[model samples]
Each structure stands twice: as C-alpha cells, then as structure tokens.
Target: MKLLFIALAFIGVAVRFAVFVSPIHEFASQRVEFSVPTNSWRRVSEGLFLYGIGVDPYLGDTFHETPFCLGLLSKLHRVNPLIIDILFPVADILAAILLYLFAQNFLEQKVVEEHKVKTSFKKESQILMLSFDCIRTVPKLVVLCYLCNPLTVGSCWAKTTTVFTNLLMAAMLLSASQGACRFYRYISLVFLALCTYQTFYYGLLFPALHLYFENFAGSKTHCRSRGDSVFGLLMDGLVFIGSFAIMLVVSSHIMGSWTFLRGVYGFLISAPDLTPNIGLYWYFFTEMFEQFRSFFIWVFLINICIYSIPVSVKLRHHPMFALFTLLPLITAFKPYPSYGDIGLYLSLFAVWRHLIPQMRQTLIVSVMLVLAATVFPVLWKLWLEVGSANANFIYAITLVLATSQVFFVTDVMLAHEKREWHLKHGVETVDKTGKRLELHLQ
Candidate 1:
C-alpha cells in the first residue's frame, strides 16, 4: 500500500513538472496588451521600473478584473504565464495529498466514534448499508479521478482550473469533512475566498458547497457546540463577502463605472429566451448543453444509479449529497459548464463512491457509463450542425464530457471491492523463523 501510494505520488509530480516546463511561447507570445484593475499591480510594478514596454497596460473601460484577483496579481513583481500555469498540476497533487490525509482522518474518526450501525435491517436496507460501507474507501477514489483525468491534464496548458479546483477541494476537506479543528476551517475559507474572486461564477458555489458539506456530510451531526458549527458557516460567508466586494471595487475602479458589475449581476438574475446566437445566456446554455448534452446527463444518471446501491441508501440523510446535487444547478448560473472543473467532477465522484457497494447497482452504473461514452460525442456532432459551426464548440464538448468521465471513473472505483479483499486477507503479517504468516487471515 505504501509502495502504491508512493508510486501514485511520483506520477502526479512528474506530470505536473512536464506541464510546468512545457513551452509557453504560445501563451506568452500573444501580443495582446492592457490591464484590468484586478491586475493593476502588474502595471504598477512595470511602470515603477519602466521595464515592460509594448504590452497594453491600460485599465480598460470596464471593471475588467475582480479586485482580489488584481490585488493578488499586483503583489507579484514578475508575471510569468508559464510559471503560473505550471503551478496548477502541483496544486492538484497537493489537493490529492490533502484528500488522503482527510480520508485517513475520516476512517480514524469512524473507528473512534464507531459510525457503525446494526447489521440487521429490512432485507433491502441491509444490502444498502453494506454497499455504502464497501465504498468507504471512495474519497481515495476521488484522488485518482482528480489526478489521472485526461481533461484535467489537457486543461493544464489551457487555464488554471486544476489549481483553483484543488484549493476548493481542500477547503471542502477542511471545512466540510471531519478533521483537526478551527485552523483548518479558517484556512479552507481563506483559500476558497481568493479562489472565488478569481472566477465569479465559481464564487457563489464555494459557499454553497461548504453549506452542503456541513449540513449534508456527517459534519453537521458531529459538532460539539452550536457556536463551533456556526463559526464554520460564518467564516465561509465572510470570505464570500470579502472576496466579492474586492472584485466589485476593483472592477468598478478599473472600468470607471459599474457596468461589468451590473452585467455580472444581470447574468445571475435573468434567464432570457433567444436564439443560441442572440442571447449570451441562451447561447451559453444551449451551446454548453449541445456540446456534451447526451454524455453528461448519462454519466450523471450513472452516479444516480451508484447512489441506489443498497449501502448508500443509509447515507441518504447525509448533507454532503444534497450539497453536491444542488451545487451544480445553482453554480451553473449562466448555463456554460466546465465538466473538467474540479467542483462538479469531484462532487460527482463523491456520489459514485457513496453508491458503489451493491453489485446490482454497480452493474447498472457500468452500463450507463459505457453507453454515455459511446453516444455523447455523436449527439454533440448533431448539436453542432443545428447550432452552426461554433469555433468554441469543441472546448464546450471537452469540458462537459471530461466532467462526466471523472464522475464515471469514480463510480467504477466506488463499486470496486479490491480494498476490502486486501483487508480480508490481512496483508499485515507476523514472521516466525523467517516464515511469514498472515495475522488476521490466520
């Protein structure tokens, strides 16, 4: 097990290193110029030295950048898109480590607290709980889903989705999952707050996720005092407010008006009806839907099937599941979705692990995955014809299907019983006369 863990760690590091050193001539070589207040620090830094020339360093006519994002970027004396991009895979790996730590803590918590229940239930419920327990090792499954995902790898060169998602995931682990106390909770919120500012669409979702994890995951029930529980909630809210305010102020200052602010809010409140090309919202949803509509929904359904596992039925009362389900619908405010993003993908994987103990349930999920993978792309091609050839169409499809694949693979691991088999055989041993004999398997 140690060897396996080490090997996985090495692979994650190597992948990140490759991406970090990968040529950034294309990314840096783009001749576009200008600055958003959110990035005013870069302008200030360059201007102070009178070093950077020919790059458009103007704060454009709108609050083009979120404030904290600007402030954070401003602090950096150097702007290397290449270095920034490389940081993501490293962050992803860090998130994986955090996840492992959390899982170990969770298992330990269950053992100490004995989250165990009576084995006897109605025939159906018994099957359900067993399956749920069987999938207990699922959080580890999430680690793999995050690490080896092709879409995640591909996006390394495209953007910093991995880094932000990993930060958010760590936030979930610290704030939502059981562990060492207040420090982690605060740490989680701080990271979440900064991350939210970076991408407004993701901003609201972070708070919502913590709310879900707190209430839905086992955390809600574990609180020792109302104040402790409430503290977590308040911290997340504070981060949200602080981050959003920074974004707004910076954007307004940069743009010389509140137009972007209004537009951002407009996107949140209204859902207009128009041709895919006319309304941005309409285009976002339809294009996003059309690109990977068939596959994403199918994969989601497979997760649903995994949830139907007899064991997972007992966890129906869990707050995490509810948070996971509602989060996507709410966060996808404008209709454009990134399946490759960690938020949706990791949550779906969590659901899959929650549901994987029942063979009947698992088998059904398997079928759905196979079918979705095969059919989703074909449907996307058809949607493209209806919508006309969209230059950004492939990106949309890739994001959606990539998200589905993350969840689908997580589902597979949830249904897996390999870990249980290892435990049963007592991989631990005692040696007598240099002849090893299994302890528990004896």
Candidate 2:
C-alpha cells in the first residue's frame, strides 16, 4: 500500500509536469472555470511585470493578489521562470500529502473519541462505527482522491494561485488536527491567517478553528467549564489576529503602501470584475440595476458571511465537519470562485466517506455536477467563440452547478445527523408502535 501510494504520487507529479509542458496549459489557464481575476497566473504575471518596471501593480484593475504573494513570486520569477512553473505541481502534491496526514490524525482522534462513548450507543450502531481497517485505509484514499481529482489537476496545470491557497489550507487542517500541541496550535492559526490574508472569505474559518481548539483544550485538560472555553478562544483569537497583522505590516513594507488591500481584498468584496466564472456573483451583479447594486451587494455579501454563524452553531461539536461544509459554500457563492475551490472541497469528501451510505441526494447531486462540468465549456464556447449562445447559457450552468453544490453540502450534513441519530437510537426505522418513522433534517 505504501509503494502504491508513492507510485500514485509520482504519477500525479508526472501528469502535472506533462501538462505544464503541453500547449494545453495555455488553454487551461484561459478557461473561466480554472482562472479568475483573483487567482489567474496571467494576472500574476501582469502584476510582476508592472512591479519589475517600477510601477504599482495595483494602480489599475489587473492584479488581485496580496503584496506578499506578489513579492514572493516576483523573486522566484527573477531567479528562473522554471521555478515558478515547477512550484505549482510541487505545491499540489504537498497539499495532498498534508491532507493524507490530516485524515490519518483526525480519524485516529475520532476512533478514540468514539471508543470513549461507545457504551452510550445502541448495539446496532456498533456496525456503523469505523472499523480498524478503515482508519488505515481512508488516509491513502483521501490523498488519492485529491491528487487524481480533475479540478485539482487542471488548477495545477493552469498554474492558478489557488494552488497555494489550497496548500496553506491543507497545512492549516493538518496542524489543527494536532491542536493538542501548543506549537501545532500556533502553526495552525498562522496558516489560517495566511489563507485569510490571501482570500478574504477564508477568514470565516476562524470560528470553526476556534471551536476545534476549544474542544481540544476541553478534552486535553478534562475541563469543560465556560471560563476555560472562553480563555482558549481568546488565546487562539489573539494568535490569529497577531499573525494576520504581522502579514499586513510586512505587506505594507513590501509595497511601500497599503494599496494592495484595495487591489486585492476590495476587488474580492466589490465584485468589480464581471468576467464570468463558476461563482454566482458576476452575472446577477452585471445585469443588476445601477441604483440597487449597493443594496443587493450588501445582501449578497451578507448572504455569504451569515452561513458561518449557523453552521458553526450547528456543527460546534464537529468543527472539522463545519470547516468542510463551509468551504464548498464559499466556493459556490464567493465573488470570484474557480474550479480549484471546487476541487478543494470535493477532495475533502473522502474524509467523510463513512457518511456516504446515509446520504440520499448523492446520485442526483453527482449527476448535476457532472452535467454542469460537461456543459460549462460547451456553453462558454458557444457564447464566446461560436456566438450561437449568450451569457444566459453560461449563467444558467453556473446556477445549476451552485444548486448542485448546495444539495451536496446539505446531503452530507443530513447524512452526518442521521449517522449520529442512529448511533444513539439504534438503526431501527420503526417507532415503538411499529409505524415507520422518517428522518427529516428540518
């Protein structure tokens, strides 16, 4: 199994290297599904060029990456363009490896927790508990799913900066899984800060991380008191904020101004660029009335931000699951999402494979997603290259894709609830009176 995993990793690397050298990468980079204004390597190149010529990259609307990212890439490009070319594939494989480690650690922790509570569960629920073999197997499957996922591969091939974001997220998850260690806790928050700095939407993950560490602190100290929870939360929050502030200070020094904030985060919040992508933001805002744009913009932005609250509350005991669910929501609704965002969340589905049998809408959601992926490029070609279709065609598919993702998230959440219920109440579907009892998520 170890040898097979290594071989698969090599194949993943070889495939990415092959794609990087192929003409297909140019076309992949151009695809709206893979590249957006925020993450596009083309935009990164444009920004680097402007910086090299002693011009502010943020002077216009070209670049939307953080000053830190711009500075790092600029140095790498100066060293050798091939370094930049090679980094994406390396980052992608590293992300996969991190995810594998996270899965292993998290599953181990889960087994220990379940073992402690096994007596509370009905005897029938024992069948649903994770088998010893599963803990050993699922981590490799997680890496396999991530490395072999088409969206991940295409994102790497396109050389989008989302690759780095995914890598940081993976590192954050792996660190968070080891939250019992003080060093790991600090490292996790720093990685989270970096992710949030690059993409503003990721800041929402702070609540989930806080919950995770709070739970960990309670478990480790055997103290579930309110004061202890609050103290832990305060400490973690301070570390996250300090890390983020340090990045901002460094970015200001690097750029000699704070203009990158307006260029990077402002672009994300304002939805200023309407170049169509997989997200729901562009088309609606593009055709929106000029007068009502501000009102609806707040509405839309609030729509994305508000989910973190209820999802955190509902999944408080399962902070990792909350993180998993919120990621796809961000991908589906954020202002400038791409296939890479979709890829990140899809790969994470491997972590919850135990819930698959309980999920009801998986088939329909899978079909919708596959159908949307198949039609997205077709509609784009018809609308742009062939001129037979219009923006409606693309927007319609985006809506379908978004709806499918929502269904997918909800299905998983429901599956989790059902699994928990079955564990406590047994797997029987009949009531005391012998009538069938249905489980409804609402």
Candidate 3:
C-alpha cells in the first residue's frame, strides 16, 4: 500500500511538472474558472513587483492577499524563482497525502464506533456495516481522486493561492481527526487560525472543528460528562482565538499597518472587484443597484455563513461529514471562488463512498458540472475576444455551476440521512405486513 501511494504521488508530481513546463499553463493561469481577482498569480506577481519597489501593494486594487502570503511569496521568489513554480505541485501533493491520512484515521474511528453501536442496530442492518476491505481501500482511492482531478491539476498549473488554502485545510482535518493527542488538537486549531487569517469566511469552520473534538472525546472515554465536553470546547475555542489574534498582530507588524484588513477580508465581503469568475457573487453584485448593494451584501454574507449552524447540529455525530458538506457550500457562494475551491470539496466525495448508493442525482449533477466546465472558456472568448456574447453569457454558466453544486450537496446530505435510518432500522424497505414503506427526509 505504501509503495502504491509513493507511485501515485510520483505520477501526480510528474503530471503537474509536465503541465508547468508546457505552454498550456500560461493560458490556464488566465482562465476565469481558475483565476479570480483575489487568487490570481498574475495579481500576486504585480503585488510583488510593487512591494519590491517599496510601494504598498494594497494601496491600489490589484492585490488582495494577506500580508503573510505576500511576505512568504517575496522570500521564496528571492531564494529562487524556480522554487515558486515548484511549490504549487508540492502543495497539491501534500494536501492529497494529508487527506489520505485523514481518511485512514477517520475510517478506523468509524469502525470502532460502529462496533460499539452494532448492538442497537437491527440484525438485518449488520450487512450495511463497512467491510474491513472497504476501509483498507478507500483512502488510496481518495488520494487518487484528489491527485488526478482535472480541477486540482488546473489549479496547480494556474498557480492559484487557493492551493495553499486547501493544503492548510487538509492539514487541519488530519490533525483534528487524531483527537486523542493534545499536540494534534493544538496543531489543528493553529491551522484553522491560519486558514481564517487567509480567507475570512473560513472562520465558519470553527463550529465543525469544535464538534469534532467533542465527538472524539466522547468516543475515547464514555466517562466524560456534558460539563467536561463543554469545558474542552471552551479551551479549544480560546486556543483558536489566541492563535488567530497572534496572526493578526504579526501581520500588522509585518506590513507596518493593518491595511490588509481592507485588502483581503474587506475585498472578500464588499466584492469590489467584478472580475468574472466561476462564482455567483461577481455577476449579481455587478448588476446590483447602488442603494441596495449594502443590503444584499449583508444578505449574501449571511446566506454563506448561516448554513454552518444547522449543518453542524444535524451532522453532530459525523463532524467530518459536516466539514465536507460545508466545503461545497463555501465554494458555491464565496465572493471570488475558483476551480481550486471546487476541486477541494469534490475530492472529498471519496470519503463518503458508503452514501454513493443512496444518492439519486448523480447522473444529472455530473452532466451539469461537465457542461459548465466545457462552456466556461467558450463563453468567455465569445464575450471578450469576439464581442459576440455578453456578461449574461458568463453569468448563466455560473448559475449552472452553482445549481449543480447545490444539488450535489443536498443529495449527499439526504443520502447520509437515509443510510443512518437504514442502519438503525433495516436495509429492507418493506414493513412486516409486506407493504412497501415510504421514507422521506424533511
């Protein structure tokens, strides 16, 4: 298994490097699907140029990255420009490896939990339990899915900063899964802080992470009371807040001011740059009336964040699944989303393979996604290069992508619920009287 992973990693790196050296990468970087105003490598290069000449890159509208990212990129460029190119593929490979590790640990814990709860499940449902062979194989398949995904490859070739964010998220998940280790919990919180520092909306992940810690604690030792669980949550929350505060203070010190607040988080919220991307925000805000802009901005921001509460509550027993569901929601509604964000969550679908049999919209959602990908570049060229199409052309595709994502998320959630019902009851849908029973998820 180790050898298989190493080989897969090698091939993944080779594929990314091949794309890097090819002419396709230049075009990939310019694609609207991969490069948004906030994450574009071209924008980053412009920011670095301005910074090198002792000018504030954030003063203008060209740069929207955090000071930490800017400083890190500047140092890497100084060491060797080649290192900058190499870092993208390495980041992607590392994220995949971290996800693989997370899946393994999660599945192990899942098996243990299932064993303990099997007595409560109907005898007929025993067959629905995960097989040892399935547990052993799923992690490798997850790694393969992530490493070979075209969106993941495109993001790496484009050199978007979302790759780094995905890496931090994967590390956070892996650390959070190892709930028995105090050090891993601290590491997880710190990574979560970094993710929030880089992208403000990622702060919503705090609830899911807190629940994961609580679930792990409860599983490891059943003696802990509700008071103990609440105390643990408080400590974790404080650690996360402290880590975030330190990042902000250090970032301010690095830039000699707090201008990045407006540049990074402010830009995300205000949607000031209307550069077309594969997100719903740019188009809607571009056409929004001036007086109503603030109202709708608040509405949209709330819409993006409000799902975390219910999703966390509903998936309390399955915090990892909660995290996975939230990722798609973030990607769908975020202000300046790119293909990297989509790829991140799509890769994680492998972690829930058990629910695949229960999903009903698989074929329809797959078609919508493929169609959106195929037409994005065509519409962009027709609008920009040929002048035959318009902004509506691009906006239409964004809607298609967003709708497909919504369908996919809801489908997965329903599948999870159905599977749980079957486990507690029986896989057979007929009643004792031999009449078909109806199961509905509200």
The lDDT for every candidate, in the order shown, is 0.44, 0.90, 0.88
What TM-scores do the predictions have?
A: 0.55, 0.98, 0.96
Tens-place lDDT digits, model 3, residues 152-233: 8899998999899999999998998886688998899999999998888888988988888888777679788989988988
Q: Is candidate 1 or candidate 2 better by lDDT?
A: 2
lDDT of 2 by residue, 75-194 (tens): 999999989988999999999999999999999999889989999999988898976676789998888888888899999999999999999999999999985888999899999999
User: Lowest lDDT 10-mer window, candidate 2?
Assistant: 12-21
Which whole-number lDDT from 0 to 100 does residue 39 have in model 3? 84
User: What is candidate 3's TM-score against the reference?
Assistant: 0.96
Candidate 1 is scored at a TM of: 0.55
- Tens digit per residue, CA lDDT, model 1, 1-442: 6477557657756765664566642342121111112222233344323223322233333223343333344444366644554555666667666766655555445443323533322333333333434234555555666566543544443443334544565656545455445455556556656555554444444534454445433444664467755876677677657755775686667545665554334332332222222112444445554667556544543433343233233333333443344333333322323323433344345533534442233554445434543444444455565664453554344444344444444444333333233333433434667676531211
For residue 75, give model 2's deviation from the true position in Å.
0.7
Give me the overall lDDT of model 3.
0.88
